[model samples]
Every structure is written in C-alpha cells, then in structure tokens.
Target: MSRESFDLDIRIDPERQRVAKQRAREGRRLMLLELGVAAALVLGFLASGASRRLKAALLGAGLASPWLLVGAYLGLVLVGYALAMAPLGWWSGYVRAHHYGLSTQTLRLWLADEAKSLALSLVFGIAAGEVIYWLLRTYPDTWWIWGSTFLAAASVLLGFVAPVLILPLFNTLTPLDDEELVARIRRLAERTGRRVAGVYTIDLSARTTAANAMFMGLGRTQRIALGDTLYSQYTPDEIETIVAHELGHQVHHDLYQGLALQTALLVGALYLAHLFLRWGVARFGFAGPGDVAALPLVALAVGLFSLVTMPLANAHSRWRERLADRFSLQATGNGAALARAMTRLANQNLSEIDPPRWAVWLLYSHPPLAERIALGSEAPA
Candidate 1:
C-alpha cells in the first residue's frame, strides 16, 4: 500500500506467487469437491428411505399445506448443504484467504458475514422455491417457459436494486472524498456522455487486501465505486485506468448486452433443468415436478448444467474484458498507467500473471495480466 510504485515481480515475491497459485488450484478443487458432496447428499436422500420418511414426518405434523412443505423442504436442503460443506467452506473461504495474505478480517467477523449471507440466501431461496413449485403445479405443461421467464426478470430486477438494497449489507459505501480524483472521474464521465449517479469508495479493506474499481447498476442506479483498497494503494492515474475500464463497459453498452446474453442463457439453462428434473422424477420415486422433494434433483441438475456451460460463459467474459481493455486504452490514452495498475492489482489480488491455458479457457473472466500489459505497446484503433 505504499505510495511509491513497485515492480510487480518484486512486490509479489516469486515464492508467494507460487503459493498463491497453488492455493488457487486448491480452491478450485475444493469447489468441485463441495459440489460432489452436495450431489452425493441429494442422491442419498433420493435413493434411500430418508426422503420418504422426511416427507411423511411433515405430513404427520399436519403441515399438509404445499407451500409450507416446500419451505420446510428447502430449509432442510440448506441445512444439509451447509453442514456437509462446513469444513470445506472454512478451509476454502477462511483458511486459504488468510494463508494467501488476502484476508484482513478476523474469524468472528468473517463468520458474521457468512451468517448474514446464509440468512439472506435462505429467505430468498425459500420464497423463490415456493414460487417455482407453484408455477410447476399450475402450469405443468409449460412450467419451464414460465420458470425461465420469471428467473430472467428476477435477475434483471436484482441488478436494479443491488447497489442500494443489496450492497450496503456487507460494506459501507461513501462518496469518494478525494476532490481532485473525483474531478478527474467526473471529467471522464462527462466526455464519454456517461452520467454517473455518484462515485463511491467501498470499505473493501475491512475484509481483503485486493484492490478494484467497477461500474454497477443501470439507468438511475448506475454509479462507479472504487475500493478503498485501490485508493490506498494506487496512484490517481492508475485508479483512472481501472475506472476507465469500467466506464468502457458502460459506454460500450456491455451491461445491456451481457444481460441479454444472460437472459438467453437462463432460458436455455432452465429448459435443461426442466428436462433433467423430469428424467430424474421418472428415474426416481419423486411425486411430481412440483413436489418439494425434487428440490435436490433441480439443484443437482442446475449445477451440472451450469458447469457444462461455464467455458462458454468464461470465453464470452474474456472477450468482453479484452474489448473493455482496448476501450480503456483509447479513452484514457494511458497504457503505461494501466500496466502499472494491473500489475499492482494482480499482485495484491494474488492473481496469476498468466495462468495455465486450460484454466484461462475454463475459469478466467478477465485476460491475464501479462496479456493486458501487452496491450500497452499497441496503438488504440
């Protein structure tokens, strides 16, 4: 976080970079392992007497209401998944973060955030589950179409509310205080014809050391936010380089394009989930498409579907990222500043400068740091 610029190689330290890379690999493996554990539990419930007994217990309790049954069913799934993944979650989320020197949070604070997130997920999940089941029951013949439509709309609505309603839950966001830098950002916004609602700095340092800047929301909700981590560590131009890349996203209309792409993909993913769930119901003893017991079937099917489509998602993301980088270069005309900023970000975030090609194709959302830096030598067209 020194004011002076530092060489990326020296600052990151080769040994530490190696450790971070190894941690990255471990983190990915743990993710797959967690999914395996979840699938296993779902399979266990479906394949054993437990699923029927649990359903029977609910019936015996006079909670014969379908809505209540779906709620309770998903609550059980959430509890099971949390318990089963607890150790792996701790290792991957807390242990690995601390080991890599990324986390600045205490265990208690981290747990508090996790608990809040879990509570939010549970509330939203149960409500969404209830709706989906209702739709399936009401319109069994074309529930997939309804489900996809509802989900696509929900995703877009979530984006509109995320800045104000969702983001404040975890981090404090205050208007960026540096007058000079604020002026610079506003100037860029003005020139680009992108009206920003506000420029804010998020309390990113409270949890992690990684620095970042981004544009969020759409229309009235649209704004730019810089992590306090970025403010503390990076130069003004470097910060501009980052923010400009985000602005590029806005100027290029990537948000709307991305949303459209996402909606199309959601429709496809939901249809696939529907098909898989139907296959599952026939293959197993689940009651029907709307049956609460089939929540696991839906989850596992969706998980598999997402994994199968990830490479496509990642490739599209990388393409958008490259375009953004090129846009930033032209907008700011500060390739050197961008290279420096990217280097520092990579080191602080423990990003591999150039990850394995397979990982890039399968997982990376942004181009590698080296690839970005190489853009420094090209003339913006």
Candidate 2:
C-alpha cells in the first residue's frame, strides 16, 4: 500500500489509547476493592452471631420438624428480604447514583420506590420457593429437569406481567411526547428491519438517578421503556445509540438466552443442593427434607457454592455485554458517539474507572468501560 493509502486506512490515536489503558487499570482496581468488600460482608454476617441467632430462632419455633420447617423457612426469608431491602436500595441503587449526579429523586421518593420493590420481591420469592419445594416433593428423582422447565416458564410469564403489573406500581408510564424524535427512531428501526413497538417514557427519576432504556415483553405487549432521565439528559443522537443497544439485545436473542442459561444454572445448583442436603441434615441435627431449622445451613452451603462460581458467571455475562456493544455500533453507525455515551454513563454512575483484574473476574457483569470504548472506536475488521 502507498503511504497515503496507509494513512487513510489507519485511525489510531496514541493519546486515546493511553487513556484507555489507564482506565482499564483503574477499573480492575475498583473491581477488586468491591469484591473484597462483598467478601468481608459475607464473612461478617456469618461471624457476627447473626447466623447462630437465626438458627436458634428457627429451632425454637419448631422448625426442626420436617412438617413445620417450610413455614419457618419462609418466615425467615421474608424477614431477611425486608431487612436487606433498605440498605440494598440506598447503597446499590440510590446513594451511588446520587454520588455521580445521575439521580434526581428525593430520598422520600427513593424509599417509596424501594417499598414497591420489596413487595414485588416478597411475592416472587415466596412463589418461586414454594414451586421449588413442590417440585422436590413431587419429582424427587427428576426435580432438576422439571424445575428448569418451571423456572423457564415462570421467567417468561414474569417478563410479560412485570411491565404491566409490577412496574406501574413504582413509576408512571406515559407515551413518548417528542413526535420528531419518535419519527426518527421509527425510521431507524425500519432501516434495521426491527419491529417498531410503542415507545413509552418511565418516570424513573421519581425513584433514582441512574438513566437507562430497555426493551420489555415479547410479541404484542413488547415495548420500549425509556427512562425520563435518559430522554431529558441525552441528546437525540445519544438516545438513539442507547435504543440501538437495547434493540441489539433483542436481535441477538439475549433475553431468551439469558433465561435458558439461568434455568440450567439453577437446575445444577438444585442437584447439588439435594446432594448436600443429605449430608447437611445428618451432621446439622435437623430432620430430613423439609426441616426449616436447617434453612440457614442450606443457605450457607449455597452461598459458598455461588462464591466459587462467581468468576465464571461474571465472565459469561461480560462476554454477552461485549457482543451487545458490537451489535449497537453496527446498528447505529455511531461508534464514536457510543464510546462517548459509555464514558458519560461511567462518570455519571461513579463507576470505578479502574478495577483490579481479580475484581472484574469475580464481580463485573460488563467488561471494563475502557474495553467497551475501545471496541466502540475500532473499525470493523
């Protein structure tokens, strides 16, 4: 190739590359710190007499008997969910978003939002647990297969109902009001051969600061939900890029794939749980099978199992996210814009720009922002 031709083909920038490297390092470091914190919390919960108190309470409540144990277990889980919701919403969803200036909602609104979430969680968790319990009793030898089937069905059913039922409880949904922008997005969807569903705006700022857009449901109820913050904060082009990313997920069948993977994982976990339950009951002084007093012991075993599998699960999710990023770039034809959007999102969310490699391996569902930006900027090869 001639010198001019070579120059035309190359779009490399050393300064951008250097910045990307620094961001990657920082991302890794931050991930490590987060993982350490999570581990410490888990250990503290086990060591601070909380686990023992729970076990004692269950036992004293007649949970040691197989018949009454399920009720006891359910009660414990309800209390745990209630206690955890406030801190989880504040730290994971609210405070971090506010710290990064992404959230616009007041504290009262945020708490109210969390209250709705708690209600939803309680309903779903109890229902799912009861289904599992029933499956174990009815199909002891084939619970894994039946359990997977049930879980998959439940996921699809929930996906359809959530937007219409659970979501409206937390935020008001209104039709998108921008006619011109809606027209442009419709054109983009048409050009990409994607089915254009109704576009709706969610009052997300009423509860939290993080901005997002999503594609929800399947078939007729399938619609696009754009957070109010995304509409107000991002320019039209940026919003288009975000919408394209969500469309990419749909195009790539990510939702179905994710559900299938989760079902398989759950089946495997339950199989192992069955095996462990046998030995656990023998050693832990609990009645077999439905003994509620042993719920804490079962949870402890599952927690340890999940901790060991964390890195593998994180890697799988990161890979899927990277694929979605590529699909967004291809669909939008706005690679640089997507990169800018990603950076803005990271900055706005106070996401650790740099985290340790070990931390990313253990905790992150998305690749480091630096990696995503680089991929966004790179030319197709």
Best by the TM-score measure: 1
Which candidate's lDDT is highest? 1
Q: Write the per-residue lDDT of candidate 1 for residues 251-337, one digit (tens) a residue.
A: 877778888888877777778778877797777777788777776677777777788888988888889889889888877888878
Please estimate how well model 1 matches the true structure, expressed as its whole-model Cα lDDT.
0.80
Worst 10 residues of 1 by lDDT: 1-10
Query: Candidate 2: how large is its RMSD?
Result: 7.3
TM-score of each: 0.93, 0.77
lDDT of each: 0.80, 0.67
Mind giving the per-residue lDDT tens digits that candidate 2 earns over 1-381?
Answer: 001111112333445445544644654565466556555554554446464566577778776653345555665666664674446446645675565455677888777866677777667766776776666666756765776688779988987787788777777779888877788778778877867767888887665555678878765667788887667766676677777777777777777777777777766676677776677667655545444444454455556667777787788888888887877787778877677666656554445545667668877888887687677667452
Clashes of 2: 14
| Residue pairs whose backbone atoms clash in candidate 1 | none
Q: Report residue 162 deviation for candidate 1 (angstroms).
A: 1.1
